[model samples]
Target: MTTTFESAAKNIIGAGNRLDTLGLAPATAGNYSMRLADGSIAITVSGAHKGLLEKKDIMRVDASGQPLEDKKPSAETLLHTVLYEQYPEANAILHSHSVPLVVLTNYHSREKFYHLEGYELLKVFPGIKTHDVRVSVPVFDNTQDMEDLGEQVRAVLKDRPASSAFMIRAHGLYGWGRTMNEAAQVVEALEVLLSCELETLKLKKR
Candidate 1:
């Protein structure tokens, strides 16, 4: 069920377009990836515009996120690799710096974690079947050090066995799933939830 290089590249391109259309990806602010048939990862190249991605914008990388092709992998490749390493079933990862996520995380006081609860969309995540469940989306302070950031993410994730996604304070959200399509769905659902949370805050201010 692993994807081919060409298939992965196409998926990345299509995913970029879809995310862009949804306004989840602006400028060069997002990265996409898929696990290839050979166990390698096909990911968007660093500095490439997600909305207008081409096949050449996608490059191959090792499971450790090392560049297997001439092009450099995304700067947050380690984040993607760490998730893939931790979750054997995760075949794709998508990271997006959306307005709602950025604003929400930035405005919230620095806290241990944020709770998302009572949303029907919660079912979009794995394991949960009811809207009554609660999920914590850990938000970490933004760091220039990918290794340090990745390690922090790993530590936070270790505490939540059922977490499907997380957010980077003042940055964006990261989502993954068993397949590229499922990963896209997870990202979309998270984005919608974040948007809803933002709107709720607006109503509270009224």
Candidate 2:
């Protein structure tokens, strides 16, 4: 069932709080959304510090991402909409610029894709039941133009759909799920694993 604006907003606000606590949505640097029953999107408005989001901070846009309210949506609204269009089962979308993710992606700049494998935490993503699995998170160079960037993202995922999340090199991660909880799970699980990977790199240097 499609979620309601009120319900979606509440979860998104609460998600903002949770993400803030985990250092994921630091300093107004992230966006969250849920696709509504009426085919509109309930998303955090642009420039709001996600950590302090309120019900009013959430706004709606049409499926094509045209604002349904006076408020402007996130600049990457097209990115979220593209995912929704491609994966009809995805209801919740998250984008964050966490430090570990940024550091890891930046350090691996030459690698077009990063691999996540052999971690039990991988189970956090749907359809994976074992730790002995390999998943490649596509990494795209950062871009300012949303239209061009969104199309690039669409092409990457279309060519080989991401299992749960994708990374914007030196930028952050984008993840979505069938529900808010699942989306949060993917974010949290990825956050944990990325931190671990970063630490491993530090240890290797030591």
Candidate 3:
């Protein structure tokens, strides 16, 4: 069944509440989107608090990130669009901000990628069947230029097609999936894993 715009809005609103409750949507720090059945995107409007989003806060945009309505989209809309274009199977995308992610990425700013291994939570992402695997999530420098950042991410992902997520240095995380439910699950799991990594680092320093 093709997802209608109304259905997409509801799913996005529900996701926002879930992410916000999990502390993944701090302030107005994150943006979310769902690819509609008609090929347009249903995304949260710019500057809207994810936890408090209403139907009016959701808007539509073309695949190129151009607004299909009179409202403004998120500043990082291109990032969502790029992901949708790169992975046709991706139907939902979530970008989140968290203390653990912000701290870890900044602390390891010199590293190009962050590795998650030996965790049962790794199975939350698509294609992982065991905790004995290593997933290298690409980390890109934060910038106001969405086009540049999106291009960098696209380039990196082109070589690593299995990757389901990425992080922004000192910024936050981006994760997507074939459905809204799966995307939310991936984002939540990533946040939890990042928190664990932070704890391990703290213990190491003790």
Q: Which ten residues in a row have the lowest lDDT in candidate 3?
A: 155-164
The clash count of every prediction, one per candidate, is 0, 0, 0
Best by TM-score: 3
**Residue-level error in angstroms, candidate 3, position 83:** 0.2
Candidate lDDT (C-alpha), each: 0.89, 0.90, 0.93
lDDT of 2 by residue, 1-206 (tens): 66999999999998899899999987889999999999899999999999999988899999999999999999889999999988888999988788898899888888878899999999888888999998788888889888998898788888755467888988889889999999999999998999999999999999
**lDDT, candidate 1, 1-206, per-residue tens:** 66999999998899999999999888899899998878889999999999999999999999999899789899999999888887777888899888888888888858757789999998999988999998888888998899999999888887676677888888888999888888999899999999999999999999
TM-score (all chains, Cα) for each model: 0.96, 0.97, 0.98
Predicted structure 3: lDDT:
0.93
Candidates, ranked, lDDT? 3, 2, 1
Q: Which portions of model 3 show Cα errors greater than 4 Å?
A: none
Lowest-scoring 10 consecutive residues by lDDT in candidate 2?
A: 155-164
Quote the lDDT for 205 in model 3. 98
